[model samples]
Target: MFVEVGPDDFSQQALYDRLCETDRASQSGAVVTFTGRVRDYNAQGHIEGIELEYYPGMTEAALQQLLKQAQQRFALTNAGIVHRVGRLANHAQIVWVGTCAAHRNDAFNAASYLMDMLKQSVPIWKKEWANGEAEWVAAKTTDSQAAMRWLQETDEPGA
Candidate 1:
């Protein structure tokens, strides 16, 4: 597992390469990766950029815990996540999550789970600058609904 929360920019390819190296024993047959980017347009319209904020220590801890859960539930051999904190321009990459597993299903599901969970429970906040106005973003109902499926899954026996 590798997790990073910081201001510095990252190379998506570099991180993917690192995740590929995570499985040293040739145990992983599939790898899946995801990168989230700040959109130029959002619900409010004409978004120029976003300011990401997070409580550094607390945010990192929460992210790590989420990753651990994904690893265990998906039987992933390895995973990596990096979340950016600070100002980001339109089209800037905001987050990266990757997983390595022996099967395609496990890697794909783990990556999907990581992104879904991070969207809801993580302490990070987004302040969007759009139409020359800046506002703190409100949590979306869809995001909450998406994350809820995992909770329901965990409630099922041996799930």
Candidate 2:
């Protein structure tokens, strides 16, 4: 498992290439990826840009823990996550998760789990800037619900 958090521009192609390389090394047959982008509007209506803040060391550790958990919960060969911070415009990539596994189901589930963990556990904050005002964005209940589903008794416990 690999996890990175930085302010560099997000690149889907680069992430895909890295995941493919990992798959080749592990002889995995399937890869799954998910990318999240900033939308033009939030629940508050219009938004121009977003500024993301995170606790450097803690954020990276939390992300690595999520990846490790995903790998243990699913039959994954490799997992990678990259999340961008700083100022970002609408439509820009915000985050990405990639997973490789021997089967499609494992890859899909791992990718989904990575996203769910990121949304719920990662200590990153976002502030929206629009109309010359900036405000902190609240965490969504839907994201918490999604993360809780993976923690149910029926779900496999992660490392």
Candidate 3:
């Protein structure tokens, strides 16, 4: 498992290459990845950019925990995450989550779960700049619902 919380930009290809080079990568039959990018628009209006901030040590710990949970909940050979902090222009990558498993289902599910939980579980904060004004982004109910859905699904016997 690899988890990084920083302000530096990362190459998606580099991350993929690293994931594929793991010692147990050969055992993986499927690799799933999710890349989140800042959009030029949102529900409010035109978004020029965003500034992300997080409690350094705490943020890393929370991310590591999420990765560990995903690993335990899924049959994953390896998993990784790279989340950026600080100002980012529209269309810039914000986060990347990748999972490798022996089957497509596991890899896909693990990647999805990580993203859903990451939105709510992490301590990162976002200040959105739109319409020439900066405003702190509030947590959306949909994000909470999505995270809760995963928790509920995992409790079901067949889910």
Candidate 4:
């Protein structure tokens, strides 16, 4: 499994190809991919763009820990995560997660777990540039709730 955090132009096709190659190499029967994009509007209202910031080594270490947790909890053959930083325009891809497993259930669950953990546990922060002003965006309650669900599950079926 690999987790990468850096500046990327965000290409879906390129990511898809890489996932396919990894899946093939790992001899997995299923692969699940997810992409998160910057929305044009936030909960407050309209947004022009967003700037993401992270504390370099800490952010990568946090993601690696999440990946380790996923590996322990799921029957995955391989997994990969890539997150972009710096200023990003509206509707640009911000994150991508790929999971490969011997079955669909594992792949699906791992992908969900990765996203949930990333949103909840990662230290990365976002600043919204909207209406000619910029402000730090608070973490969403819904995301925290989603992440909590995993902790509540005593034994994830596919884990």
TM per prediction: 0.93, 0.94, 0.94, 0.93
Q: Any runs in candidate 3 off by more than 4 Å, and if so which? A: 23-26, 155-159
The whole-model lDDT of each prediction reads: 0.87, 0.87, 0.90, 0.87
Question: Of 1 and 3, which scores higher on lDDT?
Answer: 3
How well is each residue in 6-94 modelled by candidate 2, as lDDT tens digits? 88986799989988876787888888899999998988698998999999999999998888878878878898999999999999999
Ranking by lDDT: 3, 1, 2, 4
Give the CA lDDT, 0 to 100, for residue 9 in model 3.
94
Question: Please, what are the lDDT tens digits per residue for candidate 4 over residues 1-159?
Answer: 777788777676777778777668678888889999999997778899999999899998998888888877887877888999999999998999988888898889999989998998998999999888889988888999999999898885574
| Lowest lDDT block of 10, candidate 2 | 150-159
Candidate 1 whole-model C-alpha lDDT, 0 to 1: 0.87
Candidate with the larger lDDT of 3 and 4 = 3
For TM-score, candidate 1 versus 4, the one ahead is 1
Q: What are the runs in model 1 whose C-alpha is more than 4 Å off? A: 154-159
Model 1 / residue 46 / CA error / Å: 0.7
Model 1 C-alpha lDDT per residue in residues 34-108, reported as the tens digit of each score = 999989988756888999999978999999999889888888889999999899999889999999988898888
Q: What is the lDDT of residue 127 in candidate 4?
A: 95
Write one digit per residue (lDDT tens) for candidate 3, span 61-159: 999999888888886789999999999999999999999988888899899999999999999999999877889999999999999999887452113
After TM-score superposition, the amount by which residue 11's alpha carbon in candidate 3 deviates from its true location, in angstroms, is: 0.6
